[model samples]
Target: MPSLSPPPVDKPSDATTAQTTEAETKPHAQPDSDEPINSLDPQPIDESKPKSNLDLVNECDSFPYFQSTPQLYLNHVSTYYHLRVAAYPEITLGYVLPSVAEVLRGLEEWELDDDERTLTLKAGDDEPTRSAILARTTAAMREIGHFSILKGWRNELYPVYGPAPARDLLFSIERAASALFGIVTYGIHMTAYTKSESGELKIWTPRRSKTKSTYPGMLDNTVAGGMATGENPQICCVREASEEASLPEDLVREKAHSAGTVTYFHIRDSRAGGETRLLQPECQYIFDLEVPSDVEPKPSDDEVEEFYLMGVDELKEKLKAGEFKPNCAVVLLDFFIRHGVLNAQNEPDFIEIVSRLHRKLDFPTA
Candidate 1:
């Protein structure tokens, strides 16, 4: 198996600027800087033109990025077609771009429907058979060396469950190609925080390693990882807390509370290291870990550079500045809402923001 550790951190550049090194300020911002944004120094809010946090929500759930209607969104996806497995013909499984579909059509494993708009994988009803066919197909595509997304393949598998009411497993696909198929992927994101005696709250945020592939040098939640096949949400959270934050598994199991979920449909940008504009609908299982004041998060792997404990005020400023990864920002907003930091009294779009955070995805979810 390929080693999971990223390349060693690159030497810091002498001419790095805030605009270039700033984390997730833009969807595809470059990661040339490692300087952390000082959360203690708050920026002055322009009272003349107040900004809404709803913009952050919209950026993460970018299905409406173009400010278009549902029909328009579907129209924009004209170049891609729906994917289905022969075992369940009535339900759509995923999507395939024209180029990807062209390759599938030439392969014997896939059978294009009469409409020419849907491609179905021909396999037996068993889960192993379905998974074998998909594994073979994706492997062949990877060997062809034509698709850029496959170049960064993680060699990990993500389980694809059938639509609601049918919880049986359908198949599994490579983690890197999950977005290319436009399928609903699952992950766990935990927010580690501390509450002082005076009731003041602070959160632990980590700066991603500069050498990482996706969102390098960006800020992320205390602990986060994709849900591998056969792992529950809590198990994934516990494993990530140990691997990413160097926290003890027992402590994580004891402190981490299930805080519901944050769902969003994101379009991949250049920063995500794949075909730009690809669809990636995801459901992030959320957890909130309340650590004692004495506990601190440290970088356990090359995926993280450093951890910062910041107050709510500083977090707000960074949020407005777009310093956190898009989904990580969304998850933080959800934490703020649940903790009563954001409410109708202060945020005018409170209802809309809450509504958007739990978007009803069209695809199947666990």
Candidate 2:
């Protein structure tokens, strides 16, 4: 009956924790040292990659980017509105707003929570970018009215089938990660370790390059992204560590090692099945980052085509033989049992992680 863990927390040297994970500046222009995107006959831009924000999305007849505001209703049966002095979505890459969401009316399937997709509306009541009304967002959503990907009931109400859509409309994950699934991604349970002398810490595992699109170059956490549409999650953790390592953006803003967060959901992807096929979207976030033992993780052979390091008893013996990615072995056994370097044991290699952290510290019994 001995299991407590919640103490060891020292890691702070890389310059008082660096901070500034992508403060929005180079969000659009960064793969242009020349823009041939690599060739000599290796073309794979496949084209079709524009899910939302083709100029802030408003569509047609003088869509300049919103300005109108004067429509209300409640006792008359609820139906107020705004955002139409010009309309937006001119495409900048489905994001880059300061005013635009609140495009209400049942939030068009909000990834599928269906309370008619729920939406009340706000975010540019007059005009000037704040955007956040994807239509009432739920109550049984069905296409929050119109943003047209080629309208006329956008393919028979699409996944208007209800109970999903708080955010899933991909359009390119091969067919769009399981039919647009409910889009709002961000995972990076990273590992590329270094630092050992009995002072221990060594991780680096990679082996997933099925010409990746997601899980293709799957080793686990080599910097991840998907928070677009007016982003801000420390700018998707410095735009996923400089788009998959080689470090230096002033050493990720000067060392600043260790930080954490994680959430989950996934689907077998169909990859843009005809534009965002009948979605299945349902996923959250995950961050966990901790660098500098002598920092040297520079892999982006076009998004991690695999690598390897080892230690922390070989990342707890390859996550107890399951070989990573169950949310990256629950984030490297929760950052090596929160930075003490994995201890608790009873043999059979840490007795099923102390019976899964004693069903996760549910302590109370006497």
For all predictions, the C-alpha RMSD in Å is 12.1, 22.4
Which tens-of-lDDT digit does each residue in 1-366 have in candidate 1? 111122232222222111221111211212233333222111223424434598778767876422334323333333345677777765666555556666665456677652445677766678888888777777777777667898889888998878668777888888887876777889999999999999999999999999988878878999999998899999999999999999989999987999999998877776677566667788999999999989999988899999999999999988887777889989999999999999999999999899899987756677
244-281: candidate 2 lDDT, tens digit per residue: 66655555444434454533222222221122212122
Per model, how many backbone clashes are there?
A: 0, 96
Query: After superposition, which runs of candidate 1 have C-alpha atoms over 4 Å from their true positions?
Result: 1-51, 65-68, 113-116
Instruction: Give Cα distance to truth, residue 329, candidate 2, Å.
Output: 5.8
Best candidate according to lDDT? 1
In terms of lDDT, the poorest run of 10 residues in model 1 is 20-29
Taking all chains together, each candidate's TM-score versus the true structure is 0.83, 0.24
Screening candidate 1 with a backbone cut-off below 3 angstroms (N, C-alpha, C), the clashing residue pairs are none
Off by more than 4 A, model 2: 1-133, 139-189, 197-228, 232-234, 238-252, 256-313, 323-366
TM-score, predicted candidate 1 vs. hidden true structure: 0.83
